[model samples]
Target: MRNIKLTIEYDGKRYLGWQRLGDYDKTIQGKIEKVIKLMTDENTEIIGSGRTDGGTHARGQVANFKTTSEMTLEDMLAFFNRYLPQDIVVKNVEEATERFHARYNATGKQYSYYVWNAEIPSAFERAYSFYYPQQLDLARMEEACEKLIGKHDFIGFSALKKSKKSTVRTIESISIEQEGSLLHFSFVGDGFLHKMVRIIVGTLLEIGAGSMDVSAIDEIFENKVREHAGETVPAQGLFLDEVYYR
Candidate 1:
């Protein structure tokens, strides 16, 4: 058995998400699986590092699958690129240890949320970035971000009602950068709960807009209540930049 790892990039606008659903729904996993089946004529199951929500893009998503094919890494990459849809691309393919598991072995991930805060919206970037007309106070947003770094209970940021696992997660770093009319908020963390990043971004946006103070971030962290956090930002703005493993 050969475990193959793939670095994938995709435009997530049309698909339901990463995971494969029923035949009625189209998904990223399903598309890859279809192309795999076509290339190797083997019934394979591909597992991703995580499930990106609908409309969320990915630049360096990692996935692995076990296959019995005799195809080489180069052949597999070429075959996938030829067969897979244009929206999704296989950036690289390599053989991995049989014990490799994409989700379980992941160490950390980095995500970025892009905001277009200019007067005129670009027709091409509208699908990938969130457009905000208001002027955001970047310094205030950075101050709020400083409070989020470190291990903390993020129950307030997640919307998963039945999430029984501990919400304590470590955030290694968070930074905000601006170039021209584009503003990017990036975060690196060990793991994240469902909708946690979006909610954090929304709350920070509120702080930058003067609708909420930086102290409110602390209160939400202390309260561990979802209602105390700001709204969940749109899914289009979030992108899974990379997944790390050792």
Candidate 2:
């Protein structure tokens, strides 16, 4: 058997997320897996880098599946691009090392959240960015972004129900950049807890809105409680920009 690795890009607005749901064809992974089964005549399971929440997009999502078929990589890529939905495209397909487990081998990931902070509606970016009419304090937001750098226990930022999984996560760096009316918050991390990035962004929005003091971020870390953090931002604004394996 040969392991085929794939790089994918998709507009997540049309699907229910990356994982294949039971009996649900409206998911990105489900759609891709369906096409793979149709082509290979095998109910092969594909392993994704990680789960991206519903309506969350990806530009460089990675996955792998083992197959005994003799189809060339070029044919595999062509088959997926031709048969998968218009919103989903497999950018590349190549043979992977036997031990290259997508999720298990991922070393880090970079996620970006886009905000259109303007009164006028952006006809084109409406689907990819979140619109916030209120003016934000850029200085305060940048200050909070600094605090987010480095490792921290992110339990307060996640929406997962009570579980034994550790909440400590290392955020390598953060960049908050604004060009015109678009505010982009980018984060590089070893891993992220469920909804952690969204909640952190929501809390930062509160700080920018002057509703939450910047010191509240420190409090949230000390408390380690979900209620202490900000509200969860919409998934449409989040994107899995890159995944790092090495």
TM-score of each: 0.97, 0.98
Error of 2 at 142 (Å): 1.0
- List ranges where model 1 is wrong by over 4 Å: none
Across residues 23-67, which tens digit of lDDT does each residue of candidate 1 receive? 544799999998888988888889999999999999999999998
Candidate topping TM-score? 2
lDDT scores in order? 0.91, 0.91
Name the weakest run of 10 consecutive residues (lDDT summed) in model 2: 154-163
Off by over 4 Å in 2: none
Clashing pairs in 1: none
lDDT of 2 by residue, 1-246 (tens): 889999999999988898888979889889988998998999999999999989999999999999989999999899999999889989989999998999999999999999999989799888998888788999999899888888888887799767697888999998899999999999999999999999999999999999999999889889888998888989999999899988
What number of clashing residue pairs does each candidate have, in the order they appear?
A: 0, 0
Q: What count of clashes does model 1 give?
A: 0
